[model samples]
Target: MIIRYLGDSELAQVRRRRWRKVFYVIDDDLMRLDDDRSVPEDYRQRLLAFRQKRLPDILDLADVIVAPNERILEGYPSKKGERLDPCYVTVCDDLRHFDDYQTIRILFPGSRSHLNDLAFLQEGLLRLSAAHTELEIVTYMGANAPVRLKGMEQIQHRKPLPWAAFQKEQQRERFHICLMPTVATPFNQARSINKLFDCAAVGAVGVFSRGGPTDGVIADGVDGLLVDHDVMAWEKAVGFLIDDMARAKTMAQACLDKAGLCGNPVRVRDFWRKQLDI
Candidate 1:
């Protein structure tokens, strides 16, 4: 039986209803449960209390629990003889293909929630634009993106494309690269598979930070180039590719071939089939 916490995405709800034929665990918001006190009066109190009392029992009956990340698994203890059945799927969508543009396409927008570091992207794009007229840096800026770079000709701000469309665009480019320059932080260290797979699947060589989850996906100077989180290093890597098309194509092909083994759904499915004896 497939079960999910209520109030999740409509797509998930529809899937659960259609395939599993099960009831969703309708629970009131429990974000306050970690606090020391009970919630104040609310219409959801009954649902909240019921969930608090019966969640463990519900989990015990579940054949498999899909947790978004490892942190969620911490709360659910394994029964004495029963192994915990949990699986994780990265939220990022698979890559698609779009049209080809002549200029080098560098997509390096900072983390979605952090608006402060946009200046790095703007400055980096501006410097690259000045150095090479053939470069086109496309970034989707939020409503709060800095106004200082608004008038720059080469820096075009389009409406943020959906992930699928963005992946398609990455595929179409003759040369595309994803730059992730993370300021050292615990949060930055835990970035998921989105950036690595997105670029690699579409044959774009990644210029990623030398550490973090990216390190697991990228091989230094092999599938893609890895560099310290420094602006000069970023410029050199991107510049070398822009200047040497043959090397860039070779690296891009290597990334695409390697990504097929690492992130391809068919390969991943086979891996689990062997491990789980499916």
Candidate 2:
């Protein structure tokens, strides 16, 4: 059983080899690659070319198709005789519990591709920084600390690390809040709930965009706050969480509880076991 993650350039080559049980995991809706406003122009153009030239051949060779969620499957074209069997495998990382700290540590753990999303919260974040002296911004994955955030004294930037190291370091650092702002584009809409789980694993309350991929997972005002994709709404949510430390802590704990039960590693392992028939 060969498990193929998205973005592997050698899929067509793999197909030529005729491997047994080749499963392709579609992490994002590649059909909307053109609509991704966050990716660099050259990279996006190259990706579009690759998809156009190689996708049909790869699809013909794939035995099973997997997606992060049900919604992502809607992006694929329907097959005539052969039904496209799309499996939903959510991102399930290990869960971690941490102690709350004095300073309000906010995190934006996205790659450079999240430029548009981060831009949406620029004004709100700046306002938050100005109002709260204890606000600290931690960025990773080559995500430059927003220029608007440079004026703030408490901004910290860590170079990107391997996924395993990131999880360990994130839990150890124990940021209070995780900001996950998204735009209303096709690429953004088809995103998975990975960010929600990433924040939950670190015992951080996630402030996400309303009606995004995480809508069904996060209960607004309960485990997390889901606000409209606007600066004012983001500011209000951030301020509300900052002013009430106790509530923020509670929300963080609640997030961990929900994610632990629903997105446990055991569950993910079992899913893989059943899917792979190991």
**Of the candidates shown, which would achieve the greatest TM-score relative to the real structure?**
2
* lDDT of each residue in 1-278, candidate 1, tens digit only: 33444333543545444332222222122333344122223423544564676554554344444332232333344521111222122212232222243666766544343243355455666688898887766556645456866777776666666756765664554336666665544334433545665566445677777764466667777778887767777788888777775666666667776666665576545644653567
Query: Which has the greatest lDDT?
Result: 2
Per-residue lDDT over 139-254 for candidate 2, one digit per residue giving the tens place of the 0 to 100 score? 77344556665545666667777777876776566677899987888777767777876776556898999988788888998989999978898999989988887788788878
| Clashing pairs for predicted structure model 2, backbone only | none
Q: After superposition, how far is residue 257 of candidate 1 from its true place, in Å?
A: 1.2
lDDT of 1 at 133: 88
Candidate 2 local Cα displacement, residue 32, angstroms = 1.3
